[model samples]
Target: MSNLTIVLIILVIYMALMVLIGLQGRKHSSNMQDFLTAGKQGTLLLVTGSYMGSHIGNGIVVGGAEYGATYGIGGMWYGVGAAISFYLFAIFMARVVYRNNYVTLSDLLEQRYGDKMTSIAVALLNAVSNIAVMAGQIMAGERLFQYIGLNPLAGAIATTTIVIIYSSLSGLWGVMMTDVIQVTVIVISVIATMIFIATQGGFSIMAQNLPATSFEMIPFDGETFIMMLGPTALFGLVSSTGFQRTVSCKKEKTAILAPVLGASLILLFVPLPVMIGMYGKALWPDAASGTIIFQVLFEAMPPLLAGLLIASICAAVMSTSDGILVTVTANIVSDIYHKHINPDADEKSLGRLSRISSVVIGIFALIIALQFSSLISLLSLSYTLITAGGLVMIVGAIFWKKATRQGALASFIAGVACVVINKMGVSLPYASVFPLIPSFLAYVIVSLMTQNKNAAAA
Candidate 1:
């Protein structure tokens, strides 16, 4: 059989399994709470699987490989930063959010800020960020299909349909179950590739063919390390998807431990892509960025193995995309529609709305994906917006009892303004850090100024 035919068959079988899993998960989801959080009954294994699955998306694979091509071994720093941030989140953030029984970050903001407006603002910002991130995933899948000589538009539509079908059917339950399978496939693909590469004259060839810098832990210049570490760290900590995974856990300990476990697993896989990219660099020194991983996979492996690797990449993109879509839908249904539009809506009504919102949001994200061609850019923009607009407020509200509503509003506005201005070519030093400073200052200054009024009202 032709390679294309083999890949199509594998994808068909894989998607069929996903549909079956979704049907099974539907039994567990009967209400908004069940849909959004899987009834907050996830064990550590489920939480860890879902958390890691949602994170190791197409952006990480392609972007990490690109970084490896450019910066060599130090390209691993971004993933390292992400893992560190996940660990920090587990230590400082997860337990607090879980103990509060908050199903969404907006729910926690509502409780701390004592205002529906704050929740509404957060929900909108988070929805935009999630949609943008989902668009990146769709674009990633499209690129995979394009690499295999298929129309990218068709690939995107197929990706969107599968995600929406499974996600709408069972919500978090379906997402988590499929995530476990996706992560497993991802590991298998990586391992098989590693073995194949090793048997074919491994590190020795890479060492001889590549520059010394390619093996360095940190580049001699240090600029790449500095730039990668900070934003990625912040992105890891403030990720809306990460927050949802933690809240989905059945117990506080599970929530606290899952991210750490997931981060460790991520760290383990970080070297595989970097090595692949390095090898690609050794072979094609002038190849365009982001093509290294795919080029290496197709060139180095047999037809069936290459097909499995392709499916693994699709698994990565779909797993993350589905999680983002479901969370965005939940925010719309729980925070906006039910909370504001019809406060008295029953669980059954809300559940129906959640499924409908998933399809709508998936379509909107597909449109955005078709408009954008760069996965890394879209993913980075989403992370930047989420960090600037929402992270400070979330952190402050959790740890500071005196963090007032006015302060949060000011912080969010200042941060978003800074990001907008920077994006307009204003050129700021440490662009990511620039917005955060003003955001923190605005929160502190506003909260202190409003202390007397708040106390008097109390």
Candidate 2:
């Protein structure tokens, strides 16, 4: 059979398996709570698998490889940053969020900030950012398909349809169960590919063929560190998806431990993609960075193995797309629709709304994916907005007792404004850092003013 034929068969089989998993998961997801959090019954294994599955999406796989091609071993910083974020989530945010019985990140904001507006703002921000994240996954899947002789648009539609089906069917249960399967495939495929590389001449050959600058752990310039590393590390602390995983755990300790464990495992897999990218750099230095992973997989592995690896790539993309689709739907239904549109929305109505919202948001994400081609750039922009606008408020709400509603709102506005200004061709010292200063200042100043006024009024 032709390589394309083999890949197409494998793809069909993999997708069918996902449908079966989704059908099985549907049994457990009968209400809003089940749809959103899998009834919060996730064991450590389930939580860890799902968390790792969602976080290490197409962005990490393709982006990490691209960075590896450009920056050599140092490209592992992206994964390292992600790992650190999960650790921070485990240590600081997990137990507190669990103890408070918060269903969503916005729930914490609503309870602490005492404002419907703040919750709505956060819901909207998270919805936009997560859709961008989902778009990155779709873009990656599209690229994977294009590399294998399929039309990119058709590929994106097919990928998006599969994600919507599984996600809309069983919600978090489907997402988590499929995650378990996806992560296993990801781990095995990466390891096999890495071992293949080792048998065929190894890192010394790759290192000899690449530039020394690619291997630098940290750039010589401090500004590079601030620009490249800072925002990514901080993004972990405030990721809505990460927060969702924490809240989904059945036990507080499990919530805390799962991410840390997951992070460690993810750290181990980071090197595999980086090595593949370096190999791509060694072989096809002029090829587009986004296509390097596909080139490496197809060139290095046999037809069947390459097909399996490609399926794993689809797994990575689908796992994250489904998770984000559900998250965006939850924000719409729980945070906005339930809170404002119909406060008395019953469980059945909410459940139906959640599924419908998934399809709507999935279509929007597919549109965005088609519009944007660069996965890393889209992800970076989304991460910046989420970190700048959401992080301070989340931190203050959890740790700072005096953090006022006015303060949180001010911080969010200031942060978003700074990011917008920077994006609109205004040069800043560091795009991520410049916005944070005003955001922090706004929070502190507004909180103190509001607190003192309340005291005087009393």
Cα deviation of 386, candidate 1, in Å: 0.9
Per-model TM-score, in order, reads 0.94, 0.95
Number of the top candidate by lDDT? 2
Q: Which 10-residue window of candidate 1 scores lowest in summed lDDT?
A: 220-229
Off by over 4 Å in 1: 220-227, 371-373
Residue clash pairs of candidate 2: none
**Candidate 2 structure quality by residue, lDDT tens digits, 245-342:** 77778788898889889889988887778888888889888977777988987776777877787887787688788889888987999889998899
What is candidate 1's CA lDDT for residue 220?
48
TM-score of 1: 0.94
* lDDT per residue as tens, model 1, 1-458: 87667866776777777778878877667777777777676888888888777756575566677678877887777777667778878877888877777777788899898888878988998898899889888886677677677898998898998788778776787888878887888778878887888898867778888889888899745444545666667776677677777777877779888999998999998777777778778888887655677777776677687677677677667767878987898789888998889999988788777778888899989999998755555666677788888888999998888889999999999999998998898987777566889999999999999999888998
Give the per-residue Cα lDDT of candidate 1 at 5.
76
